[model samples]
Target chain A: MKKALAMLLLVLVGTLLFMGIYAMEGFRPYGEVDLAQRVSQAYIDKDVTGENPEVVYGISKDLETGSANLVTSIIVNYRSFDTLGEVTVLFLSALGVSILFGSFKGRLRSRYQPNFILRTGSKVVFPLILIMGVYIFIHGHLSPGGGFPGGSMIASAILLMYLADEAFRIRIEGFKMTEGIAGSLYVLLGLVGLTLAGYFLSNFLNTGTVGALFSAGIIPVVYVLVGLKVGSELTGIITDFLKGEVE
Target chain B: MINPVLLIAIPLLLAFVSILYKGYRNNLLVFGALVNAGLVLTLGKGEYLIGGFKPPFGINLVLDDYAFLGLLVINGLFLLITLMSLDKIGENATVLLVALAGLNGLLLTGDLFNLFVFLEITAITAYILSASSRQYQHSFNYLVLGTLGSGLYLFGLILLYAVFGSLNMADLSLKMATADTSQLVIPSLLIFIGLGVEVKILPFNGWVRGVYGNSDSLVGPLFSAVYAGAMLLVFGRIFAQVIPLGAYLKTLLLLLGALTLIAGELAALSKTRIREILLYSSIGQSGLIVTLFLSGLVFPAVMQLFNNILSKAVLFTVAGQMADTTGTDDAEALQGAFARHKLAGVAFTIAGLSLIGMPLFYGFVSKINLLFGVFSLDNYWLPGVILLGTVIEGTYLIRLLVKLWMPGEEGLVSHESHATKAPLEIQRARVMGIVVLSAVLLVGGLMPGMIQNNLSESGRLLDETTPVYLFDLKGGQ
Candidate 1:
């Protein structure tokens, strides 16, 4: 009985305290007289000119970046560093798994390999998936698909090979080299930005015609690099995991 | 066009690839770390709109100072810790990397719902890591508490979305600042209780010790270094942006911190196991940092608080290393170890002194700053309790040290002869890293100006035109 009363009292006290805070907040002034009014007003006023019109114009016209997708322009060109970090995360994960699970070299335990129809079907789908991934990467600036989705599609192609052929094995060395080169190229591009533009990832090169396939100063180049890095790194990780456990 | 969406996409892409690496895992791990670090370092100062939409309508990823600083700490330490865990964790490496990606996503994301998704990813991976060792009882305890915490946090988000009709942090902040306070009262309380699980405040920190005690030593350090650190950053961001009830929140935080510190110290003094002692110590230290932050001591104090965290991480890592070498983490078993492995012993001593806030170490500088800040605020009782707790903390640490070094009959058995020497090259590398880190801590302690400058810059980044003075009352009040 004592314990139950103590618990009830604690709940009551907590409720009262919460209510008091809420009441105090209710009694405070609202709307035009609020403390955060200035910041909110500044935000609201921004829409009058469609959100920092001058800054937008400066990016589009003065910067000569013809990409209609301003967000893509900023990510690929202005803040490619973040994208690079994202890529590195995947690469490191693949490396860690391979190091831990790479030693196993056992023969196949399967009683039977895949039948002819399944193998043939996988082979037929492989080229289509690869082509689709390339299309996604090339048209990233104009469409919904970008480096990540495209890269995953490419990994799926590799997955097809693993399923179709019992003797199938990915070229680990080639994949690693491709991953390294892609990463290096991404960094080199940033360094180039430092020289050509004012900042490390600034896009100051020529902005091609807007809405065109070849438009966006560095968006296409960045997407291509990211796609390559992602594709290789994903393939590597999948290969490592699917290789089975080592004793 | 470079969209912030790419940040999320790039890692997801790499995670897919990680599934394919049949061998050569070390190369992949190193490659990932380098790539992530490069990206964070090179991420230029700018805001990226999501899907070419403006803020208040479309989402925005602000790559401002807060995000930048968080990126540096999370990515930098993440790489180092990953490298450190290479030999220890082995095959579970890919799972850890996936967790890292989830953590990074949690930090960089602007959408509240997305944050929840990322949080789940991190939590799920952590659960797997914790439960990997089947014999560990603490892992089960951690799962129970962690699950409860996640459920509460998710419930809070649901309530918040129902009230505000938006899931973006910036939008929530703006709406919350002006909405009917009565309507928000329940949601605010719910969110507080939910995040409290991660913050490990009083009543909520019940599971932390069990979790840390049961996990692999390497896993514990990473949890402290990355998981807890990221959560704290997230808390700070939310506090700065969303919460308008600053004074009340600060008071509650300060009181909880004081209580947690007292409880943690008393618990640590009673613990016989080495891992338990470290776990309690971390809890107490975390509480201490949070206390300083909530005291509203302004810029200098916040900087001091950050410095304390950095030093504490180093100390915890060193302690872990000492345990690895000695074979037994038990204070009774580790007695007389100082005479044998002199280098590790010296490292342990320095780290312990730093923890105790000795005058020459980085811990001392931060502690003094914290005490001074508290004193200036005329919070006499709070500082008194902290000082008393500090004494208790010193007593146990000193006792452990004495047992390790002092020679006596039937002293702690010498395990030095039986211990296998770590590779000479690995030892050299570890020692070098420790020396560099300790030197930096020492330099920062001696010349407080260097740290103060960085703190000022950080403060300016937090809010320009706001002087980063501890005693400043103009805007804080």
Candidate 2:
């Protein structure tokens, strides 16, 4: 009864506080209506009322990086730093798991023996998954998919192999080297901006013709680097997790 | 427009690679710290525009003296703490790096929403770090309180965003300066009160003692040093930029700080355990620092203040470690520690004196400056409260020291000393680190003028009146 009364009192206090704040500030819900209007305006402004009639209207002109996709431009250019940080977060999580769980010989657990049908099916689908991952990364600038999604798909390819063959394991050193090289390449690209354009990560080199595969100067390159880095890091994490308890 | 984005990016990159190559965790940490330090040093002062976009239109990272000092103190302490814990905190090294990255990002970003993102990362890492050990129930309490704190912060951010269309700090500052005063007041209160959880201000800091006491001793240094230091800087930045509401916010902070000081000191005095005492001491110190900052006592003299905070954090961490090693954090059980470990005892005494604001100690100088700053503003009561709180602080710390060092009857040794004997080399290294830090603290205290001059040079780079220091990118006027 005491606990219930305390909880009731707490709820009452919270309600009062909320009501007081709402009364003071004229509380409105998450501004969903405003966001929707802005997004719609963005679409309409780009398509119908835009200056470039041939290239598609109303959408923001600033987002014409070889990719017709605005989300891609936002992810790869406008908010690339956020994406980089996010990828690094995943990598760090993977590393933490590995450190917590990995062993010297990488033999903390025995390989799982799979049935023939499942192994055969994995063998058949592995190449397809790898192809899909590559396709997604390559066309990221023109589509919804980008580094993180594509990278996970690539990891899925590797996961297929682990399932298909009991003894199969990707070389850990190779993954490390790939991750290192990819990360360095990304930073090197950013540094290039510093040297050539007088700013870090500045995409000043080429505007390349919009809606083309090779446009957005450094966007594609950055995406590729991000893809490789994310792929290798995720694979490393999964490998560590699979490796079992640290001795 | 190389924004302070690199500060976050560099550590993130290193953290990612550290995981892939576990053998080089220490090297990666060092490299990350050095790179961040060098970047802050060379980036010069003034805001860095992002994406070639001008602010109010595009978000920009401000690299003023306040931020520069904060970055230096946080990153510098982070590097030291990582090095100190390399052997002890094995396997958890990468998480520490990520935590550092999140902290630096929190300090460097100018976007409010981005701040939330970084805050989440930092809070999550802290939760993991705090909960790494399952032996203590305090970790669970910490998790619950910490989650509540972050949730409150998020709610506050959402409210702030609703009031103003933009989330960029610079834009928000301008909006706040002209917005409806009544409408704006409540949001500001929410924002400060919400973030106050991490700041450990009064009413919102109930979890601090439990959290700090239960976490690993090494983690305590980072919390008090980098985590708290960076959050304080962010709080300062928010207040400094968002004018019109500055006075109200300042008043709120003053009251909170005073309350925190009294509460913390009182709690510390009551606590018998070493961890509890240190935890409460940290809370009290935080309150004092916030009081100084809000009272505008540190402004225009912020460089000196920053130096004080940095040294004090180091001193507190080292003292906590000493407490850990002696096996008992209990004042009664710590009898004879001074004789048993003379060097550590000496270090602890100096740190204690500094905490109590004794003459010739760094804390004393900083406290005097704070007192003068507050007195000039004609708020005499705040300083008196601070002085009284300092006395309370002195009493407990001294009592602990006397009990540890003074001759007494045989008592039960602390469980920590017997659980697993620390390697002699590790102990020696810790002692050495403490010695070095304590010496620096002493030097900073004894010769404030010299350090003040150097900081003034850096301060001039950002803004003259700011008083905190940075490298003048445009040229030192």
Candidate 3:
């Protein structure tokens, strides 16, 4: 009976979905020109001319936030509130994994470690990987890579070291400090913006000449903090996953 | 003008900072909850812009009556539930605070994408907390379902953004009102499917029973009351207001809601376990609330949600205590429950009665309002369907009450008590929490006028604020 009911509901839903699709009008595919007629057009306009003189006339993403990369501007500046939420999502996942794996008191190190060559190579490449991650986040406003990607990169490097040396203990204390400080700094900066510019997470600081490494007001600074936070959080999650729970 | 952003910010900050103070984590959670409750109660209404940018550009945080009510419910309940779960939720305290932050963001965000982000945060945190119990498979199932729901929800947002070229709720609403609504059909359906999963509407709620049953009972109220309440209101805001519901869509919601109501009631009627019973009833109540909202009975929808929060808070907390004392959560274990614990038994009876929509209870008013809404819509059959569901709901709930008041079995010991035991102080604290919840329910039942007036005003605000334009910010700082 349950299966029959399920099938019946499925058929109804499928029919309704089909009717809905058939009824919809003027829904264009991605990159259609009609999109240029709506609000995103203003964004595109601002992206091209650096000013939208029609709607919020004379206010442009370039002039207001000064991030050359549009996605970075959107993620870090235009909708930083969502970015904060995304950070919380990562933080919660990490906390959850840690709690799940935190039951065992003793460390459950890997039974087999990598060979000498792999260990030696990981040790040599770890700092270099860290530098690259830092660079990616720092240049986030001007380039493609930003906090999330950069953080994942750094965490993967750390994971490599863990595999290379089973006894290489994670200084959870340092990671905790880094994650806390970085996450709190993002909120603090937003609050600071509230005080300075009367808007939460506003571009309170000066947006230097565009295309510069240090430009885009607080975007780079926030992204850097986000990078450090995500890096530490991902490292913590990976660490917990490596230590499987006892049966 | 308090920045409503601070509500989300402060909790998130404390959640991260509490990690540093591992020894005093509970203290940090308590402090955070207290501050949030206070701020939410005192914060004035206004549009608070984020990133110093205007709407349709930078995200705006709304502080209207709808958002205000959600804030109060979430933060207020968090403080109470925090007190209840203090000893039980150890390292999971941070997750709770973060989840509260996500909920606050969900209530306050004026941007569609921001809503999606906060929804993901809440879903992820819930998944982690739910999976922390012995039944990992259930939580895993919940996580997979929730993630799929969120994926579809995000896809819907993309479609909306594609058609309207905006992500702000108000902007999208304004555009959708003027645009060809036929163009919105697919997107709206996608969103309904997505929100259906989150809000536990019928067949989409394959996850409800296991997660509620297996998780720590102390946190059960948080799921059934706080999380479910906020999500239902958001569902109303987005569907009943943001998108102009076409006739076909309205019929879809109404039928689905009535079907869900019957399905939930039947499931609950067949169940003899405590958590499963509450879980199914909760789903049934959500269906009723959704039906109310879809029928344009704003007052009853809000009233039902408020009443559900109170009753569930009372029932779940008391039920958790009953389960803890008796060892098993089965209905048979409830025999002589009143003899063992008088306060919990009475609390359960009053709350159970309210759930049955008895006279002098707030549920009675909500049920009347729901009936009026169904009739006023000129839908004659819906009332019959609703009444039938209520009858089934009442039969099982009354049966449970009888079980609770029954005499003890001589020489029969509860077999499960030996497995888990909590200290006396924790038990006392939990019962105290139950007392507070039941007190509110009593006060609400006796003076239904006050809460009804307030909820009606909120309902009026909800009705008036269709196409909520929250971007008219005044001078700040």
Candidate 1: which stretches are off by over 4 Å? Answer: A1-82, A106-113, A245-247, B1-243, B246-259, B298-318, B341-347, B358-365, B375-388, B407-477
Evaluate residue B350 in candidate 3 and report its C-alpha lDDT on the 0 to 100 scale.
78
Candidate order by lDDT, decreasing, is 3, 2, 1
Q: List candidate 3 stretches off by more than 4 Å.
A: A1-24, A45-62, A104-113, A245-247, B408-426, B454-477
Better of 1 and 2 by lDDT: 2
Of the two candidates 2 and 3, the one with more favorable DockQ, higher being better, is 3
Give the DockQ-based CAPRI class for model 3: medium
DockQ of every model listed?
0.06, 0.19, 0.58
**lDDT of candidate 2 over B1-477, digit per residue (tens):** 345767876776676577467788878877887777777666666766555544433345677665677787777777767666555576666677778778877777767766776776787677667655443466556657766776776676666666565667766666666666666655666667767778788888877776677545577766766777777766666654443465665677688888888889999999988678877877787777777656544453344335435555555555456555554455565555556567866766776677677777776676676666666666758768977887898888787766666645436434334231221122666666566666766786899787667766664444443332233322211
RMSD of each: 8.6, 5.9, 5.2
Instruction: List fnat per candidate, in order.
Output: 0.01, 0.12, 0.82
If both were scored by TM-score, which would come out higher, candidate 1 or candidate 3? 3
**Against the unseen true structure, what C-alpha lDDT does each candidate score?**
0.62, 0.66, 0.79
What local lDDT score does residue B5 receive in model 3, on the 0 to 100 scale? 90
Stretch of 10 with least lDDT, candidate 1 chain A: A40-49
- The alpha-carbon lDDT assigned to residue B441 of candidate 3 equals 74
Model 3 C-alpha lDDT per residue in residues A202-237, reported as the tens digit of each score: 888887666777678999999999999999999998
* Model 1, docking class: incorrect
On the 0 to 100 scale, the lDDT of residue B253 in model 1 is: 62
Worst 10 residues of 2 chain A by lDDT: A40-49
For candidate 2, what is the total of clashing residue pairs?
Answer: 11
